[model samples]
Target: IVHGAKRVPQDAVSDQCPEPDGFFADAEQCDKYYQCSDGHITEKLCPDGMVFNDYSTEYEKCDLPFNIDCSARSKLQSPQPSEHCPRKHGYFAHETHNVCDKFYFCVDGKYNMITCPDGLVYNENAGICSWPDEAKRNGCSSEEVFQFQCPKVDEAVAATHPRYADPEDCQYFYVCINGDTPRRNGCKLGQVFDDQSKKCDWARNVPECADWYKGRLTDVQLAELENPPTPRPRATKVSKRKHQRPRAGDDILV
Candidate 1:
């Protein structure tokens, strides 16, 4: 102002600077402007999902406390947690749940459970396969029905009963019993449970392995085997019968 003729006088006043708004524009730019020694930088801010904190400032980089909830997430997302057979493959290993707290078992060989009608049972308490008594009262089985899966195992077992292909092992059973409970008894593959004794008794007239099939052998199969047909060897000592008859004949004079 002293050197130039048009300049203002030495006593002129200057405009004041504006106060800062709360925003930092960018934490990177702020950090370049201000820094203090003491391991603390005066300016910087972390973005959302994060906290602008002292630990970040000390470390000279933002440290994100991970928002992860390790406990809330489970490793067992595959089968979902279950009460019975907790292991999960592509197929469920056990019944999930159904009537009451009891597990609703899937019918065998399918590796899944029968989805019972919601309010009722999951399996037949009658112990028959899909032979529902109430369903029978409605005449479910009385109608003309073919023998279910009869030929498959019987044909397969003819080769070698147990050694090659047994009917029971082929993921199915052969029950000769049909329709309602019989007055005599009924036969199931590899079993015959007596309702009277509540035991696995035998079916009458059915030929089974190891014995004659006079039918269900409800008593007990004798474990002691009969001896082989070979005859006993010669007698070892004098016979009492040999001594008896000779007394009257040889001692007749006396």
Candidate 2:
């Protein structure tokens, strides 16, 4: 909630209370604001990684940079950094060059490490997990991480987003966007990706992937997952509706 404060004397009042019992923002700093009560102005600052929301004088609010525009008042408070937290709040990428999936989420100088979903990497620019191709990190590109290249295909097939089976892992496959950009994907447990049909099916249905889960899962385990017994439905009770008398404030429906 970023707004331009009128250069008018009423809104731009700084260093002194413009009116009694109200809040005011500092003209030059996004994080600095003032609280005025009984004609006394007291300086205040928003927490690190947040900007002052100066949309209202009756209430004071601080919000994240994503929700506030600070082009006019870009100045912020001094950073209160801590271990793994650069400014007391925000998402940060892992320090390791090759560790693309892990990152840190910091709040108030404390850190919580997070891992991206499979086949995705942490995108520092957007502060969220995204595709490796989109993350654009030098050592974290899809090819560098997956070690697989998209096979050359005609424009017709490329435009359809072709799916290819992983050569090393029968349960996994690669989705080639425009026949160039590759993204890794996988079949569900107890199933394998079928290149011919471009879908997941029971391992026994795909000869090439019949032994895909051989060492990882026993035959009995795979059988149970493929053909698990269904559970009985639970009994439910339906309550009967009762007539109610009209109340003074209740609206009667015809």
Candidate 3:
């Protein structure tokens, strides 16, 4: 019984703080820090060769040694350095653990991370992403990655037959309809689209044609088939008169 008065347990200190726009110390862990922005918080760990310094000012927040090569560490790596990430409308190497298959699109220095969809890769030579097979066939290096979706066809071409070979898939094609999103279709086996004939035909017959074939007729061909030319009327046969004694008599009278 050795106490002047029983000490009351102080209420647990609140760890809450105002919203932050930059780096700050972790509320529970001294070795960690929180990256705050837009009323959100993200836990982060220092990159390799860096350490968390709590005394850093706002301008020099997340203070780490100046000698550390922070840029080498990808954005996916913990405690992303502010300097290396791409700004708005700019492109940068994606943070991928295995294949470099993704890229970040900084919208106004924030927002989305754009990537090539399935069956595609980014092409650096074209300065945009594209299908890997296309890029390779087009002589683009394997190292470069780029791709994009089908764009609107030209007005002149749109009014005509809208068939176009797909650069991504040889077996697939795009059929533009009234300048809207092109309809995608596949070619039949053992046939291909014949540009000269403007129809799908046997691959053996049209070696220069694309790999896939739809076997569908164009609008003009269909119209011609529907309205065929009418046959001309046959000439009437005339009877010839007998030229025996009548001929001799007619000559004498004349």
What residue runs in model 1 are displaced by over 4 Å at the alpha carbon?
A: 1-121, 124-148, 152-166, 169-173, 176-208, 211-254
Expressed as tens digits, the lDDT of each residue in 1-254 for candidate 1 is: 00101322223311111112221122322111223333222333332112222333233332222322223321211222333423221222124222221232322222344443322222222322343323242222312121232233454443432221123222122233332221122234434443333334334422343233335342343221122246779889866664445554575657
Q: Using alpha carbons, what is the TM-score of model 2? A: 0.72
Q: Number of the top candidate by lDDT?
A: 2
With candidate 2 superimposed using the best TM-score fit, by how many Å does residue 210's alpha carbon deviate from the native?
1.2
Q: Estimate each model's TM-score.
A: 0.15, 0.72, 0.23
Q: Please state the error at residue 121 of candidate 1 in Å.
A: 8.7
Q: What would you estimate as the lDDT of candidate 1?
A: 0.28
Pick the TM-score winner: 2
Per-residue lDDT, model 2, residue 38, is 71
Question: For residues 23-85, what per-residue lDDT tens digits would candidate 3 score against the true structure?
Answer: 566544433455555535555654332335556525323333332223333232233233434
Off by over 4 Å in 3: 1-156, 209-254
- lDDT (Cα atoms) of all candidates against the true structure: 0.28, 0.84, 0.46
